[model samples]
Target: MTRPAATAFPTPDDLFENAPCGYLVLSEDGTIRMVNGTFCRWLSCARAELVGKRIAARLSVSSRIAYETHFMPLLRLGGASHEISFDFLDAGGGAFPASVSALFCPAGEQESSIRLTVFPAVQRRRYERGLLEAREASEVARHSELETGKLREQFVAVLGHDLRNPLAAVSAGIRALSREATTERGARVLVLMEGSVQRMFGLIENILDFARARLGGGIVLTQCITDQLPAILSQVVDELRATNPDRVIDASFDLRTPVECDPSRIAQLVSNLLGNAISHGAADRPVRLSAVSTASGDLTVIVTNEGPTIPPDAMDRLFEPFVRGASSGYSEGLGLGLHIASEIAKAHDAVLDVTSEDSVTSFRLRLSAVRAS
Candidate 1:
């Protein structure tokens, strides 16, 4: 076998001069006594140029302050300090972040010195600044979105209010014409016009109510204990029947107890539910409305219709404003009827729920009763 060549190890001076990080030795007075090639290269200066200078002279203002106030005192007490952040200035007057660690050697007979190593921290600093900027941008976007929503709701409120005057004028003209004598054909035309006006009025009311509720006024109520709930509900059914003469509606009332609630609002809610049923329910089948008052002073009203079952995905968002049923072909209204009805139910402290199965859909409203004293 050939004799193995002698293993050549790196000399001490070679290791010190070619270290991966910046290295420096400083006197207790803070003058640089020695520096490695890596440190000189980092500052874009020669090692001889940096050896005699004070280390503070190479630091930025803020870093100099931190070094003198915090880094030096801690090293003197503990004899060692690790991971202190400082910004080092180059010969070109540019600055870069560094993580510095130092060990203090006390002088017994030799001169005391501090040995320091520096690691670059540019990437960490950049990452921290990016996180801060992203958080600020997110907050600004959230505030702008809220402001835009408020403006849109205000526009809806204004538009709804302005439309009422012209609608009232049209309704007045129709009524005036109805009072005069007319041929049978003219009478039928007048009736159709009246129905159209009523529908427009309902749509306007829904829009106004939606705006009011969204603007924080909520659904205002004038609650009273009344036995006229059955009559009020019956009138709602009659009005829907008048508008849809060809559709069949069956209504039953067994309200034997008075309940404390907003009568007009209740009528509006029932009208909305019945109208939805008439529009979306099967045209050949009869829509049913049942109002029952229990001896325990609770009131329940249910509206049922035979139709295609509501899809499972739509059940969660059924009461959200402007959400319409995906399967319903009739698209006459703004899809606010169910939403307004739910709001009315909340105002009365009642529960409004729905179920659909086996080609039938039902909406149930339950109210706790308050009998007249």
Candidate 2:
């Protein structure tokens, strides 16, 4: 039992014939000088047939153009080229993808050869193309979604605008009949009609405001210096009480300072809060509305009611558009009241906040002296 003697370094012929990847050595003018066995096997050709031929003849049409225009120029300038992808033609005229890397080798003072290695890249190229197609499709779908959203907002704006004229005529007819009614039953029926008209008008206003906020950036405010804010808020409460005769609302105001704000927007805000209270508050308990001006020159309005506590999850998105609380459902008008109120408060340079616990729910609006931008 003895060990064999160590072998010498592998000869050039042995190394070139058994190399893993297809290898070629070509003249600077693109004539093939030598090729490895792997290269001949890949193209199903004999060494004698390819040795004296132009290497570019083995490439497919587009690959031949790429090789002549880009790869050859880059190799001449840089002495090397890496990851040049091209399609190669086999003996049967079928095309396969290949990635080539080459280095310039100087054989003499006046002559050079290109030594190249080729790797099969058919599957990898297919995967890269698939990724590009997927990215393009995703971008197209995203653009279509944005366009659809804009169209929907525009349609809502137009619909709200067209509804106002007929609503105005309905109100005019109601007013005319109110003056002519003599019997008590006729007067009651007219009152109900007026209440319905007012409710419809409020719903339309909310829809228009929502459209403006989504399409035109946000709600706009017209600020004016006024001393009649208390009366305006009182009018909102009076209307809600008239419409909902079964509910009792206790409203109190303690303000002595002049306030600057968007009067109409503020009225809308209070009205929304009162409406929310009437819809959700305990029927037997009275809803409370309080407005006070602190000595620090801050105006605050609070609306409170006693009812089932809002779930923690529902409270988080209570002011988001189209997101309703557990108590709000299909009957509510698109769940935009609290959302619009919040936007109005923001336009007035104020904040709308809420708190609920122990069967009591309260929403508060705090307005400081700073004007909205």
Candidate 3:
């Protein structure tokens, strides 16, 4: 066998000079007593020029302050310090981040000294800066989205208001033509046209109300004490009965005490609830509406219908704008009726709640009937 070559090992001086990281030895007074070749190259200076200089001279202003106030005290007390961050100034006056660790050797027969090692941290600082910029960009995007949504809602409100005049003109012309003599087929066509116009009017009303509530003008009510609430509610029932002739609506009133409320708004709320019942309730079952007033100045109105039970997951979002029941076979409206009704109840400081079970669904409203002082 050939003789094996001798294994060469690096001596202490060779290892110190060619190390991957910067190394330095400092006296207790912070003067640089010794430095490795790696450290001298990092500062772009010769060993002779740095050996007698203070280590503070190579640090940036803030780092110099931190070194004296924080780093030196910890190393003296604990005899070792790890991962202290600082910025060092190069010969070109540029700064770079560095992570420093140091070990203190106490004095015995010679002066005390500290041995330090430094690693560059340029990549870590760059990553942290990138994270901060991305967070700021996300916040700006969210704010812009909110502003755009508000502008769109305001546009809908304006459009709804502008459409009312032409709709009213068309309705007036239809009524004038209905009064004139015509064949049986012509009369039936006129009736169909009238129904279409009524449906369009209902849609426009819902859109306008939704826009107003979203724009912060909640339901505007004119409240007063009146005994005519029963009559107002009766008129709403009659109107819906005419429109949905195939559906049976049972209404009963026991409103003995006068109630304080906006009559028109109350009428509208009842109309929405009744129409919902007619659309979703079982065809052969009667939709029920009942109103009662207590002597202690409290009022209650309930509407009940027999239908498929509402899904549990959907109950929470039923009153949210533009949300409709998934089980409904009728898809005629914009799904704003219940939301508007809830808003009206809130304006009156009333409680409106719904429950569906055993093939029955009911919406109940309760409010104080006392006159406002």
Candidate 4:
């Protein structure tokens, strides 16, 4: 045998009275029969004021209810609850946020003796305040970042418009000159001018929409039927096919329900997901899309491609700004599409999820159904 177990030393009752933390012993009727100096000072009440008083009588109504509903049971049942938090209001209307913990004990053989303990968490509470401040500062920085990005987009849009107006004029002038020249050289000039004008138009449209969001004018939402979705997607698909002759799009959607959505924003969300998939997913394979209504009045749409498995840890930060996963191209986009799409989804009370395994990756959009109007 190593050594005998040491007997637990017991402190005197007076030692408890001078405890560093607050302490009180209450009767079953909720009368404070004994307390320490720490509690009296912590509550900012005098001994005469706190003596024989009910805990609820001093606390605010909310605190009182919290005590009655939770604390009372915990104490009465001789249970322990830790780190319970609430606000206490003083007589002068000064509110103090506090974290408290309590344990109940029997004084003797009878359960009528209820001993309770409470302590102030000033340091922890101060840390919580610091966290709140940091969160607010982060929000301010995000807003500032968005504002700066919007200014850049707006500048680009304005410049594109100024340049395009002149290009359009020159294209028109070239067409008129081609009509007068009636030669092969004139035809080639007309073709080049028309191609340049079309390219400029597309770039300007994308930039203008991105800039409008910076001014707090987001994509407006509407309730639309599922029937209209196929045609809308077909239009985008046809446009993509014109440039990428090697790629094919497969679209499937359920016809059973309508959804609350902003059509253009929803389209943009899908287009980005699909574009990302096409850029990273296995080439020479079909990129698939499908939508269906759930029994819970939710609509779920999935875009899947047969390529890439994202790492476990990366999934958590995938939607975060500037964090790119294997599913994204090396020089694809600025990492804002998922962020913007996520905001759009929130505006519609929707959810977006990305999952990958082996070489198959899927992005899903889930939206609540809107009543047909």
Candidate 5:
């Protein structure tokens, strides 16, 4: 092996003033001999102010005590000390943390000199404190979310229980009045009452379902073998038509396969879509409902209405809970209808999609009819 050439190193003058850490040279009695730019800048003082002064005089009270009682004696006995932590007084009269390492050198039988490297630890201290605060804030947020969830569950339970009792009593009273009404005007009032009650019932059911989906796993479906999907959808349309006789709801169905699904959920899904269309669609145009079964064992339901097109930005969040359409031309309910319909579609393993263009909006639900094993 060839002997390596001597490597050139930076001169002491180059390294002393511009070292990464603060550098100092002191007399044997601990008076400063020379100070670097880094050391002087760290103390926010000029080199002249520190050169003839004792380094211990610039230390914080506690650090001075530690230096006088422990460090000075240790250096005298062992000729060196390493990694001693202390505090330095800054220009603002506040103390900042620092770590120091010092080495002693004897010069020709004369008094020894000391060389020290000082590392300012302000950033390290700030980082440690920041980490502690972040952990505490995370813990507080987690606790708050837990409490909020518990309160939501309790409110949902109480609301569903208390509101249903009064609603049932109102329904019973309406039925009694309907039986006694003998005039056409009274009969019309009873019809209006019936429509109002049905709408209220739908709203309450939506609230309960929304609560269950939020607090529990999701909407639960009771699937069974049934060939009544068209009938269920037709019934939903008829009910909505009854409530809004002026708006035309044209429905068409072609189903050739018996489906395995939750009939009530399917009906609810159509009901929600129909209600949305009736509320937002152009009043003068007919809302169309179509259901078809494909040869590949899939059932599809499509609801279309002519209305102002939904904005592209709004489409992404259309199915989010409590989000209402911006261009729907009307405000209604809690904006939970589409959200509940989406959850019902998920329970049936279906895809629900919406498209809007040229002042027409369509919602489609496609369900796989493959029997569950």
Candidate 6:
């Protein structure tokens, strides 16, 4: 059987003696009927001295004006004044910020007097000022960041558009010479010219992709994570291996744990980590990868390699955009890897972690827990 609720304790007299805040009861005729210790301390007056005294006579002029003209009208009508702020006159006649509210108390068939609650507003004022300052600072920082990002984007756009013409002219000249000149040097020059043009185009595309990701729309999440991960990883590994034939990669995966996530973005994360390991790992050593189900039911994927130590300074900033990884051979495209990984992880509510030492450097992506069913 359920138990009945306990009886309510304490009378009004006891409440005045132990009120959490200042309380003062004034007679309708303006005499102080009763005052709690809290009110006595707030106004810097002793109970013996303040009892039976007139609140209007002792209160600060501004506080008295507000109380009598505005708050008293509301309180007499059986309504309350909500946190009307003013000041009180201390025993030494000093002013202090205060917030007060009052309500009419019932006496038999009629209202007896007003019960006033007072609170010191010093801490509250300070807190409000601090909050205002924090908001202003945040807005300024955001404005500065927006301005800087726009300027950088403009610079990239102008640079790419301006350089395209010069690259075109160079390619046209090399082509014309290869067709007319009968020398072997002409053929090799044409090949080198074509290679240089390709490299320029690749760099320009990377810059564009970076800007797009930064100012782009949200991740387009796919319903499939299980089937997409393995296929994407295999393709990325094959592409990287073909480009760097000297490096050997050993990749292992098991993504049976299904989850809702963006496949291309997830693929971006996988490719970035794997490519990072391939580039940093010793040429003869194997770049290792593993994907398994963690005890917490999330998918735990790790990419590791035996390589030179990552400096403490660089490790802290490794995932930041434009930061060069463990290997300095990276150009513009490579810097966006870890940065994109971070974006993808955040979109999936997953965690991207990195650890590095003398012989072992690893990056892991911790996915959300999948349902057993």
Write the residue-wise lDDT of candidate 6 on 1-373 in tens digits. Answer: 1222333785766667656678888887668888887777766778877789887777688778987898778776756677888777878888777788787775877657777888889888789889999999999999999999988876876787678888888878767777785678767666766756754654554455466556565444564635456676777677666556678888887766554566666666777787677767776799887877544546778889897878889888887877776465644354766776777777778899888887888998887765334
Question: In model 4, what are the clashing residue pairs, if there are any?
Answer: 307-359
Off by over 4 Å in 4: 1-215, 222-226, 294-297, 321-330, 370-373
Tens digit of lDDT per residue, candidate 4, span 148-244?
9877877865786677777778768866777785678767666666655554554454444455555566645665544566566666566555444
Candidate 1, residues 183-284, lDDT tens digits: the string is: 999988888888888888888888889989998999989988889998899888988887798999999999998877899998999999998898889999
Query: Where in model 2 is the C-alpha error above 4 Å?
Result: 1-55, 60-84, 92-94, 100-117, 182-185, 294-297, 309-316, 326-330, 356-360, 371-373
The per-prediction CA RMSD against the true structure, in angstroms, equals: 6.0, 5.7, 6.3, 11.4, 9.1, 11.6
Per-residue lDDT for 1-373 in model 5, tens only? 1212333785777677767799888998889998888777777887788889999888999999999999988888898899898888867778868889998897777777999999988888789789999999999999999889878866975697678889889989988988893799988887888888888888888888888877775798898877888878888888888889899999999877777778899898889998888888899999999988877658899999998888888899999988876544676677889999999998887899999999999999989876445
Each model's C-alpha lDDT? 0.89, 0.86, 0.86, 0.68, 0.85, 0.73
Per-residue lDDT over 1-373 for candidate 2, one digit per residue giving the tens place of the 0 to 100 score = 1212333775677667756678899999999998887777777777887899998999999999999999999998999999999888878888878999999886687578999999889899999999999999999999998899889988988998999999999999989998894699988888888888898888888888999999976898888766688899989998888888889999999877767778899899989898888888888899999988766557899999999888888888899988755564426567888999999998887999999999999999999976566
Root-mean-square deviation of candidate 3: 6.3
Q: Which candidate, 2 or 5, has the higher lDDT?
A: 2
> Which model, 2 or 4, shows the larger lDDT?
2
Per-structure clash totals for the candidates: 0, 0, 0, 1, 0, 0
Is candidate 3 or 6 superior in lDDT?
3
As for candidate 1, its clashing pairs are none
Models 1 onward score TM values of 0.77, 0.77, 0.73, 0.47, 0.72, 0.50
RMSD of 5: 9.1
Give the runs in model 5 whose Cα sits over 4 Å from its true position: 1-11, 14-20, 24-37, 40-95, 98-135, 326-329, 371-373
- Alpha-carbon lDDT of model 3: 0.86
Winner on lDDT (4 vs 6): 6
